[model samples]
Target: MSQKPSKSTAPEAENAAATRGTRLFLGLSCFLAGAAMMIIEICAYRLLAPFFGNSVYTWTALIGVILIAFSAGGYLGGHLADRKMALDLLGWLLSGSAVLTFFIPALHTVFAAGLSAQGLIAGPVIISLLLFAVPGILLGAVSPAAVRFYSLTLKDTHVGAAAGTISMLGSLGSFVGTFLSGFFLLSTFGVRSIFFGTAALLLVLAVAAFLLAKNTLRQQAPVILSGLFAFFMSWMTAPKPKPGVIFEHESFYHHIEVSERTDGDVTRRVLQLDSTMEGGMDAKTGDLILPYQQYWKLALLREPAKVGSALFIGAGAFGMPENVSREFPEAAVDVVEIDPQVIEVGRKFFKLDEHPRVKAHAGDARRYLLQSGGKKWDMIFGDAYNGIRQIPPHLATQEFYQQIADHLEPKGVFIMNIIAAITGPKAELTSGMLATVRKVFPHVEVFAVGYRRDETQNVILMASREDLKPLIQDRYVQQGSWQESLIKTHVPKGTVPHASYVFTDDHNPVDAIIARGLLE
Candidate 1:
């Protein structure tokens, strides 16, 4: 042992060391590839949200398609690895994934915009497949390839153990990536930047893989050039807003934008979340331009004496809050909006800061109500929605209405703004919400803001523990106003047909119900 080793022994020792190095490299590659797959899957939700909406259907399509693609890729990869465990192929797969991942931002805009014209059902599925399938397949293949390569470095008896270790490592990497992308990366960086960072990471992994395989520079040149070219194309094709977009922001919750358009002498500024116009106002007079806002006055009319303290569940542009504060100057208005960015946009562009008595709190409305230390209110308004068409499922459930009831005074009124047609198939949401509210309140009345029965309109549901008939008459006789006239003219006479189904936390089919409503 003290003497120099023989030439044959020296070569064996060098080979053993090189084999260990190759094993370590392959393990790392598998881990990184697993992480990249999850990152892309999670980010896909945000990328498609602005166009297809962050709905249950969209998520179902995305997760289902990606899983199917992964299954196929894993089978194909194992087959290829059995025939020949080549390092160059692994390098090519990673390089190709990086290039495709780089193009995601640009591809999302083009595909989503084009497919959306086909309708919600077809659009979301087609867009998800087109954007995520190839990258998911490529990433899925890496794990199988790595398993085969690692087994080659080990004894035949230990192959099973090596395969298990590789799988566990890949799973661990996926777990880490999920938390990091959701908790850190999404919060700190923009969507486009997240994609860019992912692409860069994969590029590094590709280069390392090629080097570990001892490939020549000529062999790696094509991969490097393709990545560079893809990056350049993506940068050049990035999305830009159309004319008249004043402000645009992407929050953890929503894709928000403010745009002003002039029609004749009136300049209307609108707040849009996702694809729907949440709120709008006349720029000149600061008056609420949306027709549904006029119906919020029904809450005041229903409880004139108890209008001192009011709570607004959803503060879109603070239009309803502003209107309420102006109408009842002595009232203390508390607005609980879930998104802080929306609150900021409200104060900056929607004149929310002008009201001295109005205060905005950023949190979920139901959670805030439950934890507000027994603070009771005269009027509780629920305008919480995902878009104009979809009410957040939690806000539409029976337990939520009970919370609303508990937060209100003994004679207080709760007004909710809902979108539904008066009759036909579109009435399910209205019917279900009415049934849920009636479970908590003694008196519930429905008032349609617009007179049209055929079109989808904003239907206001006024609920209270006491009889609202006397209060409505009292307010009408006192004011003798146009609001009273509008209320009398538009309020539907008959009861809702599908009032049998009540939405609960465990069984809320709001999305499916809304989809059926739209289809009919």
Candidate 2:
């Protein structure tokens, strides 16, 4: 028989079990920190979106700040870990991150709005740094602290195994976080709620860390309870909607709000997405209040002999589609609004009525045009502006314009609402759009809705197969009512110079161009 195997003593076995427990707890803490870090990074976009827009600049700033924080944290965390071997180091790092995470939602509006007013480019960077950097650093500190703690608890001196195992767990947690947040958390919950959830998860891990350090429950109760209280208070104290904000929601694509504004004789309900006032309706009468809604009637003025059907890319509560339904009783008006919630708001608050001719679909405008299977419309309205300076990239491409042209009847007209400076160094946006649209349509006419030529404001671009020069000229010279006067005065006699570079699906920078124009 082999030499009699000696059974391990109770103390030795207990020590082994305790080591396993410590390692497991440290691993769990790291995994959670990794998940929380990703959740915070992803949701940071939504927080900044309402003020700065979800632009490339916003993303660039978030990613850059987060990475730098991680680098600094890793360096500092390694130093702290070398100096101390206590499990509470990882706990405190997570605890600090949790506190900062709770502070985010309360501070986002104040930081984003105040910073954005200063400079668009710098605003995103500064806000990202102010809001996310400390939390990121604290979270990032978890990895090195965890690895060191894990190494200390290991019975075998395989340092690489300990580090690799911890890193793998953290990475696995990151994968789960990316999938979970993108597929579910964002769509299923609001931004602040997501923030609070993340904070709670982190605080729990901090408690676990303390417990794993062999600290009695009594020792950590005060600290853990304080965090719970902070989380609760933050949730309770979140800002309420402003005075006239009757409806506010965080849609998948936008931070949408329907608010009322009154000025002496005028009162209106405005649909706001992020920082842009998409459209408005009179508070009492529910008539269209945006000047563009009225200006877009230039299509009706040209009045395709028979408009059997029409498509409006983005229908807000302007009552334009309803107007089209009534104005042209024979026309079948289809409204494609991307956000379904916006449609609900229109129905609930803005008095969108049901008409047999006016049907609404909640989906992408481009996909609608593509899947229409050569179905033609007499009039196509392009009023889909998704951001302050960011128009959906797919919509601004040459391919999309061609699709619009292809889906129109021979006498069909396409009217697009563009916000750009009509004349000045900042006119590149209008020039680029003209160049791109001209590629698909032989004739295009532009009317300035904004009185100031150099001011960045609404400019209507109209395109069709048949030239409406005589009709345009007729409207230009003759004036009677305010509507006619608007047509007569704003239509430029000469066309803008087309940009040398065209916008194709593969390569388009409309968002950057617009932002640059706005800034410069």
Candidate 3:
């Protein structure tokens, strides 16, 4: 109590406290900035899915463009740090990034529609760059700037150690962000809400950063104004359904939309997943309007006892399964649709819950089949499609067909509805699928549902261990209607040449094939 500390020592202690505060602030800033960057990247996929489709090509474009943006950001950030490593500058960067990010949802549909018209490869790349490149650059700059601040704040600490620690924290934050956003955010919060939440977090980070730097209100005015402008603009410009769209939802698997259109005398309700027409039904009669639905009727011609139980891999609009339940009251029908939301939509809009004989199971078709154990089906229908009428890669593989064969009864028929052209580059998908299915089933035949040679059409592939001609001939005689005429007109009489590539669990180029087909 007798002696007083020296002025120099007291000042040194104060400096130490101030440095510690700066380090803490910068560390938290870097961590959060990194987290925000990754969250936006993951959300970008969902945002783009409605237009570009969530495919390998879309992801490739996103990842590649984001990496390039990061590299440029890091380079520029390092250069700026060497010249003027100020917290206020970092604050501006974060604030600007937050503003741009907030605008993403508002601009998505507009940009997507405009760019997608260019084709898939160029479309996603250009759109990703337009939507995310600026923010990625701004966020990437945060890391190097953070390193500079840490080095300056902790003069006693080794520069290399400080840099390593800061970078590691950023990476750790990224890891957490990736898992949290993918697992929790997408499921818990809607896509637009997630973007809004991300922007809010960034805004908070920017404010804290600017306050720590002791910035004046006047100096912070522009950032505040920009953020406000972005928020209001985004709120005003958020996407809305087109005039006739009665309902729309962002499911974990797809951007589903239901719309109504009126013809001369009848109205039709259509179910669209992303950009592909999944199914349609007559509004008044509830009759399936898609031609593929009519073809599924052939399953009735399989073994009489075999037709007692059947499975449908995809349940779009529940059209075929509901029809089966209604037409064959004795038959037990099980439908597996991967998206639960789609099932909900089906029940709410398509009357999926009204059928007692049809049981809806929500899960991957392949996984459901594998887990079914000894449960066999008389007829298995595979109508699962992804993107713009492309079969899911896993469901189109040789191993998956083997699973189908195992789950089928002795004379069970496997009817698959796939979209591809009959004769052109697009026919590769048809040939490849046929080749894969042939590996497991002894007899296979192709029927062009639309009978279009130049345009992409729904090509039905029917395979069975037993000959199907007898069933077709029998049904032809019984029905003696359009079903007979369709078979004769659209069904291919000769075998198709084997495609250059076979789809397998290990190697599947279905996305690339579809992209080329769509581009052409």
In terms of lDDT, which candidate is strongest? Answer: 3
Q: Worst lDDT window (10 residues) for model 2?
A: 474-483
List the candidate numbers ranked by TM-score, top first.
3, 1, 2
How do the residues 288-393 of candidate 3 rate in per-residue lDDT, one tens digit apiece?
8877788777675554533678899988888888877777788899999998888888888887777878899999998898789999988889888863534678
lDDT of 3: 0.82
Cα RMSD of predicted structure 3 = 2.2
Q: On lDDT, who's better, 2 or 3?
A: 3
Give stretches of model 1 more than 4 Å off. 8-13, 117-119, 263-266, 283-285, 303-306, 471-480
lDDT of each: 0.81, 0.81, 0.82
lDDT of 1 by residue, 177-285 (tens): 8988888777677778888889989988998889887898898998899888888888888888868899988777777899999988778999988887888888776
Enumerate residue pairs that collide in model 1.
Answer: none
Number of clashes found in candidate 1 = 0
Candidate 1: lDDT of 111?
A: 77
Q: In terms of TM-score, which candidate is stronger, 1 or 2?
A: 1
- Judging by TM-score against the true structure, name the best candidate: 3
- Ranked candidates, highest lDDT first: 3, 1, 2
